[model samples]
Target: MGNANCVFCGCIEQASVGVVEKWGRFDRLAEPGLNFFNPFAGECLSGILSTRISSLDVKIETKTKDNVFVHLVCSIQYRVIRQNADDAFYELQNPKEQIQAYVFDVVRAHVPKMNLDELFEQKDEV
Candidate 1:
């Protein structure tokens, strides 16, 4: 059972219950009815990096140097180690918009830095 004051419970009640995956790691768990969350559970995800707390994810796709048109996806996970739920919510907008903006900014910054030939020639550099 969760306390009425619990943010998780409130979110479940007021909004839709959605599963949030950490960096595409862990089977997305129900957003509702969770009691205390242990960071140890983070290990359940083999390739995904779990944050000590809940985090945000960002993904993007772009073409390769050879114009190979490769799809690239990236995710960034950030958690509030301070345990301030209010602060986290206020600082980071809901995942979708925030993630889109972050991915775009990151991709845009990196794209210009590399030339088509550079990307193809230095395959391992990136």
Candidate 2:
């Protein structure tokens, strides 16, 4: 028998929330604090989801419209919406990779249409 008073407790660290799944499915969310759940029964799993604003820098190498090969470093800042923390955590297995992929896609799509000189002149527009 599982210990009655030995239930698992999780602590959602500062600037982060928690996603609790019951039997391999999402059940609810736990805000930052001491969260309690049953672990011995294998009924629940909790994962911490960060809600802090963070930045990602991606280095992409691509050819410009002028056929100039260039290396560009793009930096973006983002955060998981507090109310959408569950979706962010569940929908994205690796948030960093997803962000990087999106950055690469956007940069490649826009940069290739502009010459190197235009790219520098309209950096903010891109």
Candidate 3:
């Protein structure tokens, strides 16, 4: 009864792709245009899921050599790079999680090598 637009629907609907599945295990045709669907639907849905490139923004604070604290915000965008859509989804949950894990690892690996002054000077390198 809820007529909700596809969460992935956008102006680029033309470029949209479809995923064939059952419709909530309910043996009923919810909509038209479904290519492949399980007729006897108990708890399944035929839908198209979209995977898009995502970015994560992280802010890190460190003290400067002059004893002043500074905060740095880094925005990083990363995609699955892999062409396998299913594999990418199975491997990477979402953009935020990927970004947080990657950025944290990167910052941790390099932060200790530099002091506050060096950290400030090399901020852009990150």
Candidate 4:
């Protein structure tokens, strides 16, 4: 059974981090490369998180002040700060959904007040 426990070894890739948990609670972050944990001792690799930059595209549909329907694609780029890896992992269970809500709120609030040309000209400001 001792040898069987070694099967839980995990190979973490470059630019990525491993979330280690002890007895089902977050333990620590493991660096890239081979990492070993003993499940027999209640230690395991809970998840893998990327330190590299990532981009998310959110589509928004709202109306202009002139009542023109417009669809916009907003690209949001983000990266996990290695120092805050734990927060990134535990802070929000559904970040994408929360982000979508924020984007939707901001666009919906601003778009309805701007004319089509104003929206086009000052989109970056919004």
Between candidates 1 and 3, name the one with more favorable TM-score.
Answer: 3
Which residue pairs show backbone clashes in model 1? Answer: none
TM-scores of all candidate predictions against the true structure? 0.40, 0.82, 0.52, 0.82
Q: In model 4, where do residues sit more than 4 Å from their true spots?
A: 1-8
| lDDT over C-alpha atoms for residue 63 of model 2 | 91
Per-residue C-alpha lDDT of model 1 across residues 1-126, encoded as one tens digit per residue: 111121222223222232333433434433333333334443121111123444445455665534554455555555543334333433554655766786787675665566677765754544
What is the C-alpha lDDT profile of model 3 across 45-73, one tens digit per residue? 33333444666788876544455566768
- Cα lDDT, all candidates: 0.43, 0.80, 0.49, 0.83
Q: Model 2, 8-120: lDDT tens per residue?
A: 88677899887777656677788888888886555454567688889998999999999999898888899999899878876787889989999889988999999999999
Ranking by lDDT: 4, 2, 3, 1
Model 2 lDDT on a 0 to 1 scale: 0.80
Clashes of 3: 10
The best-first sequence of candidates by TM-score reads: 4, 2, 3, 1
How does candidate 1 fare on TM-score? 0.40
Checking candidate 2 for backbone clashes, the offending pairs are none
When summed lDDT is taken over every stretch of 10 residues in candidate 4, the lowest stretch is 1-10
Report the lDDT of model 4 for residue 45: 78
